[model samples]
Target chain A: MMTLIVLGTLLYSQYRKTTSDKLKGSGNVPYYLIALLAIGMAVGDDSGMTMILPSRGLLIWFDPILEKLIE
Target chain B: MQTLRISSNQIAMLTGCFLSAGMIVSTSKEMVYQAGQDAWTGYFFPMVYGALIIVISIWLYKGREGITLFELNKKLLGGIGGSLLNLVLFWYLLSMLITDLRKLAEFVKTTLLLNTPVSVTMFMILLLTVYLTRGGIEVIARVGHLYFFLLAATIVSLPILLINEFSLANVRPVMANGLEALAKSSFMAVGSYGEVIAMISVMFAFSYQKNPKGLHPMLRGVVFGTFLLTVLSVTLIGTVGTSISARAMYPNLMLVQSIHITDFLDRLDIILVSFWVPSYIIKICLNYYVLTECISSIPSEKQNPKAYTIVLVPLVFMMGHLSFESVVELVHFETHVWSFVTVFLQVVLFSVLIVARLMRDRQRKKEVELT
Candidate 1:
């Protein structure tokens, strides 16, 4: 479920090119939103960090799909 | 008169300092007891993986064009989605900073300043970091350079200190843990080396050479950083047996504590820690820069440090307090979860984007030819 959400955000960022930066929102709510979300992940389940470290062989294979998607 | 500043050399020094980030805390005999005598070899694979990462990063930003990861995130992701991705990236930077602070405070309390609250240590360090972050990237670079000289002076004396304990047999027996240990060690190392991922943010904000060609300096910096990390790992495994090395938090500290040049040279851990502070300073600057840049890059956004830093201070403080556990917990999580996400996101994710972008470009070229 969480992967889906994170993947969605990643995909969306690729297409939208729109970011919620200090210059965007008036209240600075988005700033904290981003900070808390990121730190939360750092402190989140270590096991959940699987999206980053696949086995070496797996990384080599995942390379192709990643290229297609990000491009 | 304009003040003299740090050049690429200084930045390289800072990188050397951080290369030991989890090493000190995680290489403890206890922390790495899982790997037994093979822990040093285990650390070697990660350095190899990290070297690969550095090569790719330099390739991606070939011109020293200063294209930040956040900006690249946008260019690759696009307007709205890219912006949001930057936000997520921003927080990732924050979380790392907090984790570093937590580690520093823990080391201080356990080894020195026994009565000092973690908050006091963290706040003091972070306040210095905040001041440095606002001092501009050049100043950050300059300060890092100065510390590099100091770091060099201290690190060079390692052999002198550990000369008594030197033994070749301790690291004997090639492939002691079998192939599996090598594989797992590489995996653990992937995350450690991945800490260099923090560079993308700073590289982006760096002064451009009109193109990214000068990135060789950064790449060279990474090579130097890895070399130092390799030495630290080997010496650590040497001075302390693999079992003890893995279990001791800040194994390097233990290594330092064990070293004795003269009877008068006993308490040099303080000297090592003093030399260590600059690397943390540069590292803190890097983290804060990433956080600030991510927030500032919000489309149509202008940053006011007062509004941002004020809130950031306490939030970071809270994270430190909340995560006051043994180095083992930190290492367990870092090697497990942190390692996974960092490798996936930094390496796997980028590789994916490059492939996608290239294939798409090729497809478009084909369509143009057909037309």
Candidate 2:
């Protein structure tokens, strides 16, 4: 996808531009976190993403239970 | 570093407009639906609640001039702790941005640009937001000030324009379902109206004209927003009656549709749609700036703030597209999921920050005296 390519380039550029300490210290975790989140959202149901966080299999079981509670 | 400064009035307009703009179309309908005829009460609850949030947030930053909540997070929580919190804040703001874009896209698709794809509409708005934000917050604040009157006039004049249709009987049995229903609706209102918490990002961006009276122009601006929202709710319920307004997706848009104006001016919903554009853009830009600022807190990111917007555009587009099954799902998410999380962040997280700041200050004072 265009987004993946763009993001890959940005990440590579960012990775090359800054040191590991700066990246870690500057709070670059969100870049990876958000990249994964976008992929999960785009893949839809199969991504098994929960509404709350970006973990792959973490809350997949919980969402259905929450839905049942709403019902 | 060259710091940008906007007046307190600009801050007030920017924050006030950001908070109130989309309520008429998106959130107020749910409140009316939940509380029946008494939904006007929902407006008052969040007004008081939001004002308190502003007070506490401002007080927390009172002596700590030039510091943002993001910096406070770094100081109190340390690098890793703060980065993790920043991730949480990113999720919060990003989720909001996606939702707002979806709502705006929905409005555009339904009312104005019927043939346009929702993704296209959303992309268009985000494109504008990126442009606004690249100018930095000052430009956005100035734009909010410039168009504040146009936005306010369009919103306030709607109820007045449709005064002929209101029925006093509509809101008659005000607390018919009693306090419990009202309380439920108020809780939901926190998600929609109490988003003033987002303004804390821009709090330090404001340069006060005078040496600070307690929350002066900012509080007034917030009160004005609340007043507009309350009036909007009252007008919708009074005119369309509670049951009809409750069921309507956009009660205010419906109100605009009801106006004949003249034979020539009948399709005034188009013009009303124009009002939402600036206000919604202001809101989106504010949130986007906050998210970007949080992201930029990473040392590598400090070099390129606007670069992230390029990456965010497709992510936002996809999230807005894929997040909900329908408008029903969107409303359900807003009431059930988003409301509680937002309140928790505003109240509980803010309290933690205040306590942490106090302890930090005490330790600093002790060291000063020791020296």
Best by lDDT: 2
lDDT of 2: 0.71
Q: List model 1 lDDT by residue over B1-371, tens digit each.
A: 33323445555555665565444455334324545556655655666666677666655554334466666656665667667766656656655776677677777777778999776787678778777876766777777777766765666677667878877677676566677656655566666577777765556446433333555555566566656655666676677777667656667778778877777878888888777666666777767766766666655343543235433554455455444345555555455555666776676556755664566568879999999
User: DockQ (Cα-based) per candidate?
Assistant: 0.06, 0.23
Deviation of model 1 at B175, angstroms: 2.5
Candidate 2 CAPRI assessment class: acceptable
Best by DockQ: 2
Error of 1 at B109 (Å): 1.1
The per-candidate TM-score of the B chain, in the order shown, comes to: 0.86, 0.94
Question: How many angstroms is residue B87 displaced in model 1 relative to the true structure, after the best TM-score fit?
Answer: 2.5
| Clash count, predicted structure 2 | 2
Compared with the true structure, what per-residue lDDT tens digits does model 2 show for residues B1-371?
56778887887787678767857666777777778888888767777787887777667776666756676677776766666676577778877887787888888888888999887787789889988987987888888887777878876897777877878899888789788768767766777665776677656645655345666666777788877777777878888888878788878888778777678988887787787778888888888887777676654334345546555665666677667657776666666567766787677677777787788889999999999
